[model samples]
Target: MEVKGKVVVVIGAGKSGMAAAQFLASHGSRVYLNDIKTRENLEERSLHNLEKMGITLLLGAHGDIAGLQPDLVIVSPGVPLTIPPVAEARERNIPVWSEMELASRFTKAPMVVVTGTNGKTTTTALIGQIMEDAGFKTFVGGNIGVPFISEAEQLQPQDVAILEASSFQLETTESFKPFISLILNITPDHIDWHGSLEGYIKAKAKIFARQDEKDWLILNGDDRETRALAGLAKAKVLFFSRKHILEEGICVENGYLVVKLEGKTVPVIKPEEIFIKGSHNLENALAAVGAGWLMGVSAESLERSLRTFPGVPHRLEPVLNIDGVRYINDSKGTNPDASIKALEAYPDPIILIAGGKSKGSDFTSFAEMIKDRVKALVLVGQAAGEIEEAVKKTGYYNYYRVETFKDAVYKARDLANQGDIVLLSPACASFDMFRSYEHRGEVFKELVHELAKND
Candidate 1:
C-alpha cells in the first residue's frame, strides 16, 4: 500500500485507467498512463493536464513495462490480462492489480458490490440511493459510470461505497472484498471477451471470492447459474426470487416485496409502488430491499427510495409519444436475456428495433420468444443478418433490415400502429455503429422527437 515514489504502469487510458493514473499520481506514485491508441488519436489537452500532474502518458502502445522496472502495474477493465504486457508483468512477479483492487486499498468505507448480467445498474443505483436517503455519505460507481479510484481517497469510514461490478472489472481483482455482495442473475454474456460462458461466470464469482463468513452474498434464486454459485461463497448467502417464496431472503408474495429472515416474514413494498416497470425490475427491487434490510436501513426508507429512484436511463426509458405510438429506449439490453426481459415488460404489440454488434449470443430463440408479442421487427448493426435468419426460422415474415440507426428508427415508427410500442432493445452491444449504448439510445430518442415534430 506504500505507493509514494514507486513506479507504476497503468494500462488503457480510458475512464478507469485515467482515474487510476490520477489517483496514483496524487498519492505520489510515478505513474505511466498507456493506451493502445496513438498520441495523435488522443486529446492533447487531457494528456497535457496529466503531464502537469507529473503523470507520464505512453500512448499508441503498452510501452516497456519490464524496462521501466515498475513496482506495480494497474490495468483497466477493458484490457485483458492475456495481453502481452500484462502477461509479461505477471511472469516477472510484478503485482498487476485492477483499478478496483487498487481503489479498495485506499477506500475505508464498507462496500456494497452488485453484479449480474441484467439488473446491476438498477440494483446498484437503488441501493446507493437507499443508503443516501437513510443519511449515509455514499459513493456510487465502479461499472456504472464513475471510476471507484476517482472517489476512493476521499471515502470516510462511515461512508458506503456502492459498486456495480462487471465481469471485466472482477477479472483482474484479487482482494476487492465487500461488506455485502449481490449477484442479480447470471446469463451468458461477453462470450467473446471471456472466451467462454464458464470463464465469464468465474470472473463474476470473484465478487465474493475474497469474502469470509462475516460478509454477505445475495444471489438470485430463480437463475440456475446464479443460484449454483451459492455453494462457492464462504460468505452468508441470501436469495431474491420472483417465482416462489423463499425460506430466507426476498421474494414476491401476493404482489409485495417480502423478506423472510430468521423465520420471520416482513413486507417491504408493493410491486405497484416500485417506480420501475417489469418483473425483472421487481427482482432488482427485491435484491436492493434485502441488502438495505441487512444494512439496517429502515423499511420506510427502502420503500421511499424504490418509489423515487427514477430508474437508470436507456434501460427501458420511454422517450416520446408520437401520436398514440409509444417509443421505449432499452438500449441497455446488450444481450439476449436482457432483451428477452424487455420484451416481457410490454403487453402492447411491439415493433422492436434490435440487433447490434454481436456478442456471440445465440439469437436462434430470440425471434420465437417475441413471435406473439412483437408485431414487427427492425434489425440494425452487425447482427442484422443473424437475427433475420432467426426470425425466418420462427416463420415471422414482418421483419425489416436497415443499415443505420436513422433507418431502424424510422422503419420502426412506420411499422408501429396506434397504441403499439416501438422498443429500441438491441440484443447486442452498440460498438458496431455507435460509441456506446447511451449514444444509440440518444439517437433513437432524437429520431422519435423528430417524428413528434413532423406530427
Candidate 2:
C-alpha cells in the first residue's frame, strides 16, 4: 500500500477518478490522470486544480500506459476494463485496481458494502444512519456521491464505512472485501456496460469474493438471481425478503419487520411506522435492519433511525401538490425495473414522465405496468421513441412524446387531473439530458416548483 515515488496511472476524469488521483498524488505517487474527453468537455475548474496539484493530465485520448510503465493503474467505475489502456496494463502484468479497491487498502474501518440493481443507495444511507444512531462513527460514500478514497484515510478501526457498491465498481476489485456485504436484489441493469446480464451479476458477486467465514453476505431471498449467489459465498449468508417470511433472515411478519437469525427473533418495527413507503423500501429496510442488528445495534436505535430517515431525495420523493395533483421525483429510476417499482408505489392515476438515455433495457414490462397504472405518459430524451413503441405494443395509446425535458414536465402537469400523480421516473439513464440522475431530479423539482408558483 506504500506508494512513495511510484508511477501510477488513473483512468477517467470524473469525480471518482479525480479523487483517486488526488489521493495517490498526496501519498507521493507520480500520478498521470487520463480521460478520453477533451479539456473542453470536462469541468474546467476541477481539471485546472488537478494540473495545479502536479498530477499530469492526459486528455482527448487514452493514456499510453505501456509507454508510461506505471506501477499501478486505478480505474474509475464508469471506465470499462476492456478499454485498450486498461487491457494493455493487464497484459503487461501491471496491477489494475478499482477506486473502491484502492480506497479499501488505506482504510482500517469495517466496511458495510451494499450492492444491487435498484435499492443500493437507499439501503446504504439507511445503514449509515442506523450505525451513527448506535454511537459508531460512520463514513458513508462509494457510488452515492463522494468517493470512498476521499474519506478512506480518515476512518479508524472502530468506525464503519457504509458504501453503495455498483456493478461497475465491484468488477475491478482484486482484494476489496467488506466485513458486511449486502446484495439487495439483482435485476437486468447496466447491460450495455457489462455486455450481458451474467457479466453484471458476476461483477456484483465480487463484493464478497475475498470475504472469509467471519464476514457476512446479505441477499434478497425474494430474487432468484440474488438467492442463488448464496451457494457461492464463503461468508455467512443472510437473506432478506419482502414476499415471504424467512426462517432465518429478515422479513415482514404480522405487519412488522422481523429478523430471525442466530436462534433469536427480533421484531424491528412496523412497516407503516417506517418513514419510507413502498414494497421496495420495505425490502431495503429489511436489509438495513440486518446490517444494523448484525453490527450489534440496539433495537431502540434501529427503530429511531428507521422512523426518522426521510428517504433519499430522488427515489419516490415528493415535490409539491398542485391543485390536488401530486408530483413525484423518482429520477433514480434509471432502468425499466426501477421505473416499474416506482409505478407500483402509487395507487393514483399517473401522468408519467419517462425516457432518457437507453441502457439496453426491455421496456415491455414497464409498458405493461404503465398500461395498468398510468393515465397518460409523457416521454422525452433519447429513449422516448423506444418507450413509446413499447407502450403502443402494449395497446396503451395515451402517450405523448416531447422534445425537451422542461416540455415533458409541463406536459405531464397539463395531463394530470385532480388526485392524479405526475411522476418523473425515467426508465433510462440521465446522461442524455442532464449530468446525472441527481441533476435530472433537481431540474424536475425546479420545474414542479415553478408550476406551484403559478398555482
Candidate 3:
C-alpha cells in the first residue's frame, strides 16, 4: 500500500487520473501521467490542475510501458481494460489500482462509503452533512469529485470522510475498506463497459471485498441483487428496506424511520421530514438513516439533518415554478430505472425530456410511467429515436420528439400547461451531447432562465 518514493504511472488524465497522480506525487512518489488527448486539449483546466502537482505529463501519447518502470499504475473509471498500455501493464505484472483504493490505503481516516446504481449522490451528501452538523470535519468527494486521498493527509482522525463510490472506481480497488460501507441497490447499468448485467454486479460487490468483521456493511434489503451479495461481506450486515419490513433493518414503521435492533425500536427520523420525495427518495433516506445510526449519530441529529438537508442537484431538483408550471432538472437520470424514479416523484403532467446515450436499459417499461404522467415527450441526444420507438412499442404513441436540448425545452414550454411539470430525465448517459450529466443539467437550467427572461 505504500507508494513513497515509488515510480507511479497514472492513466487516463481525466478528473480521477489527475487527482491520483497528484495524490501519489504529493506523498513522494514520482508520478507519470498519460492520456490520449492532444497537447492542445491537455492544456484545458482539468489537466492544468495536475501540472502544478508536479506530475510528468505524457499527453498526446499513451503510457509507454517500455520507457517507464512504474511501481504502480492508476486507471480512471472511464478507462477500459482493453486499452493498449493497460493490457501491456498487465503483461508486465505491474500493480494497477484505482484512485479510491490508493486514497484509502494512505488515509488513516475512517470513511463512510456509499455505492449504488442510483442515490449515491444523495446518500453521500446526506451522510457528510449529518456528520458535519455533529461537529466532524468532513471530506465529501470520490466519484463525486476530488478523491479523498488528495486531501486525506490534511484531515485528522476526528474528521469524517464520506465518499460517493462508483462501481467503476470499485472495480480496480485493492485494500480499500471503509469504516462503514453501504451498497444502496443494484440494477442493470453500464452494460457498455461491463458487457453484461452480471459483470456490473461483480464490480459493485468489490466495495465490500476488503472489509473485516469489526467493520460494518449496510445493504439494500429491498434490492435482490444487493441482498444476494450480503453473505460475502466479512463485516456485519445491516439493511434498509422499502420492500420487506424487518425486525432489525431500517423500515418505515408508524411514519418513523425506525431502526429496530436487539428488541429496541429507535426512531432515526421520519420519511416525510426529508426534503427529497418519491419511494426511491424514501429508500434513499432510510439508507442514509441506517448509515447515520451505524456511525453513532443520535436520532435527534438525524431528524434535524433530515429537515435541514437540501437534496443533491439533478436528481429531481426543482429548477423553477413559472406560472404554476414546475420544471425539474433530473439530468442525473442516466439510466432507465433512475428516470422511472424521477417520473414517479411527481404526479403533474410531465413534458418529459428522455434520451441520451442509451445504456442498454429496456425502455419498454417506461410506458407504464409515461402513459400515466407524461403529456408530451421532448427527446434529445443520440437515443431519442430509440426512446420514441419504445414509447410506440409500449402502445404509448403520439409523443413529440425534438433533437436538441434547447429545442426540447422550447417545445416543452409550448406543450406544458401552467400546472404541468417539464422534466429532463434522460434514461441514458450524456456523452452524446454534453461533457457530463452536470453539464447537460446546467445547460437545461440556463435555457430555462433564458426562456423566463424573454417571457
Candidate 4:
C-alpha cells in the first residue's frame, strides 16, 4: 500500500490506466504509463496532462518496462496478461496488480462488488442506489464507466464502494476482496481475451478470492455454472434465484421478491412493481436486494430504490414510441446470451438489429431464438455473415444484411409494423464500427430520434 517512493509502471493508456497513473503520481509514486499504441493513437491533451502531473508516458511499445525497473505494475482491465511486459514482470518477480487491486488497498470502506457475464452494470448501479437511498455515502465505479482508483482513496470507512468487476479486471486481482460479492450469472463471453471458457470462469471466481467468513458471497441459483462455484467461496454464500423458491436467500415466490434467511421470510417487493422488466433484470434486482440487505440496508429502502431506478441506459432501455411502434436500445447486449435474454423480455413482434464484432460466441442458440421471436432481423458489422449463416441453419430466412449501421436501423424501421418493436441488440461487441457499446447506443438513440422527426 505504500507507494511513496516506489517506481510503478501502469499498462494500457486507457481510462483505468490514466486514473491509476494520476492516482499513483499524486501519492508520490514515480509512475510510468505505458501503452502498445503510439502517441498518435491517443488523445493529445490526455498525454500532455499526464506529463504535467510528472507521470512518465511510455507509448508505442512496452519494452520500456524492463528498462524502467518498476517495483510495481498496474494493469488496466483491457490489457491481457499474456502481453510480453506483464509476463516479463511476473518472470522478474515484480509485483503486478490490477487497477482494482491497487484501488482496494487505499479504501477501508465496505465494498460490494458484482461480477458475471451479464447484468453487472445494472446490478451494481441498483446496489449503489439502494445504499444511497438508505442514507449511506456511496461511491459506485470500477468497470461501470469510472475507475475504482479515482474514488477509492476518498472513500471513508462509513461509505460504501459498489463496483462492477469484469473478468478482465478480476483476472489480475491479487488482494481485491469485497465485503459483499455477487456473481449474477456466468456464461461464455470474452473467450478471445480470456483464452477459453474455463479461463473466463476462473477469472470471475477471483472476485471472492481473498474474502473471509466475515464477508458475504452471493450467487445466482438459477445459473448452473454460477451455482457450481458455491464451494469455492470462503465467505458466507447466499443464492438469488428467479425461477425457484429457496429455503435461504433471495427468490421470487408467489408474485413477490422475498428473502428467506434464518427461518424468517421477508417480502421485499413484487416483480411487477420493479421498473426494470425481463427475467434477467429480475435476477439482477434479486442480487441487488440481497447485497443491500447484507449491507444493512432497510427493506423499505431496497423496495423504494428498485421501484424507481430506471435501469441502465444501454440495457433494454426504452427510446421512443412512434406511431405505436416501440423502439428499444439494448446495445449492451454484447453477447448472444444477452441478446437471447433481451428477446425473451418482450412478446411483441420484433424487428431485431443484431450483428457486430463477434467475441467468438456460438450464435446457433441465439439464431434459434430469433427464428421464434424475431419478425425480422437486420444485420450489420463484422459478424453479419456469420449470424446470417447461423440463422439460415435454423431455417429462419427473414433477415437482411446491411452494409452500414445507419442502414441497419433504417431497414429495421421499415420492417417494423405499428404493433411491433424495433430493438437494437447487437449480440456482439461494438469495436468493429464504434468506439464502445456506449457510443453504439448513443448513435442508435440519435438515429431513432431522427427517424421520429422524419416520420
Candidate order, lDDT descending: 4, 2, 1, 3
Worst 10 residues of 4 by lDDT: 59-68
Query: 1 or 3: which has the higher lDDT?
Result: 1
Q: How accurate is candidate 1 locally (lDDT)?
A: 0.90
Model 3, 213-286: lDDT tens digits are 98989999888999998888899999889877788888988878888877889886667777777899888888
* Tens-place lDDT digits, model 4, residues 116-221: 9999999999998899999999999999878989989788999999999999889888888899999999889999998899999999999998999999999999
lDDT of each: 0.90, 0.93, 0.84, 0.93
Better of 1 and 3 by TM-score: 1
Q: Which clashing pairs does model 1 show?
A: none
Q: RMSD, each candidate, Å?
A: 1.2, 1.2, 1.6, 1.1
lDDT of 4: 0.93
Tell me how many residue pairs clash in candidate 3: 0
The backbone clash count of each candidate, in order, is 0, 0, 0, 0
Residue 103 accuracy (lDDT) in model 1: 92
The list of candidate 2 runs beyond 4 A from truth reads none
lDDT for model 3: 0.84
Per residue, candidate 1 scores C-alpha lDDT tens digits across 312-341 of 999999898888999999999999899999
The Cα RMSD in angstroms, rounded to one decimal, for candidate 3 relative to the true structure is 1.6
TM-score for all models, in order of appearance: 0.98, 0.98, 0.96, 0.98
